[model samples]
Target: MICFFLFTGCEQVSKSIKDTFQPKVDTIAVEKQQIPDPVPYDAAVERQIEDAQRLVETVLEKHTKAHVQYIEGKNTDFLTNEKKLNRAEEALKKLPQYLGKEIFIYSSIHFYNEGKIRVMLQHPQNPEYIDNYVYENETWSDPEQLSVKDNIRSRLISLQKISFTNVAKAASVYNEKIKQIEGAEPITGIYISVWDNNLRWSPASINGSRERYSIELNQNGTLKKFERE
Candidate 1:
């Protein structure tokens, strides 16, 4: 009788162990979070435009330094220290937003007399876009990018005759105007003026020899004019 009791107790213990070892099912609820919208290409385009402005400034700086050395017949520390100038040129070449296939890059001073300076990358497919650094007001998709042309002409016509400040001011104005047009609330349309002075070259003296001038813009950053001495 005691053996029978022992066997019965063992069977009961085995059943309890099996029940305890069984896996339990679990149910979990996870809340998903919503992601924010991505930045638009228009914003990227705007950023590119701003970058172009800075690049243009850098190009002017390099050109001016190189010009001064060439004019004075001085050994170009700039030419020897070609890292910065070369990088600046490369950056300009990459700036399609500003300098498109229609435009060409040339040595700023000698470019005037010399016709069609050599371009780094040409649009072989498009014969019209032969010059990668030159921009005609008549040709480009965005005329504002060609603001540098008028700016150059103005500097050339100045009584003082093509001072660094003149070029810088024009660059600043063009940049400011572009920013302004971009900032226009509704952006009905964008207009950039490249007016001609048609003034004869005369030897005029400037009071100060400052190489750059400040251009103040309206609401959107269009250049109103310069802060003259």
Candidate 2:
């Protein structure tokens, strides 16, 4: 027994009708998005080397720890002419053309060891890079960088010491003696090591036809010992 004329009854009935006929809206839950942080900068990538140039030059001039090796029956014209080999020479000849006026420091200069590749890291003005000059098909390719080793960091050397000049001189001084041995293959390798301010160079034949000899020189470049091994 409800009366439609009553306000409450009319309002309730209207609400009921609306609920029956009205369209429903659905709600969905959303998740918040998160963005990752970028990688940190490495200071070692730009770390500069120090405290070796002058000392290295002095060492080079001494020829104490330097080595000069000739391949079996190979020409050594490049050593005698003192042709463009050092960083300064490279800077003067190739860098100005390839890298402009910015100077490139040598990050990988060392004594000429046997079986070592003689390539320069070509990333101009950046010693931190590990890429070396690559030549192929009579054309020079661009440098490619690699991960620098943790233990063996870059060691700076002199710019003007004509790469392996002292070594060549040392070789010449001992070449006469090494070649003097009768009926033996010519020296195929020269190894020089310095210790206690003394220099010892061993010119090895390694061909089994001749014995290897170790020759030591004083700091003043005088012969100290010569022994057959």
Q: How does candidate 1 score on lDDT?
A: 0.32
Give the C-alpha lDDT of model 2. 0.42
Q: Write down the worst ten-residue block by lDDT for model 2.
A: 26-35
Writing each residue's lDDT as its tens digit, candidate 1 over 52-166 gives 4664465444333333222332222222223433343444445655444433222122121111111222232432231224322212222122222212322222212222223
How many residue pairs clash per model?
A: 8, 0
Model 1 CA deviation exceeding 4 Å by range:
1-42, 54-64, 69-229
Which candidate number maximizes TM-score? 2
Give lDDT per model, in order. 0.32, 0.42
Error of 2 at 107 (Å): 8.2
Predicted structure 2, TM vs. truth: 0.39
| Per-residue lDDT value at 146 in model 2 | 46
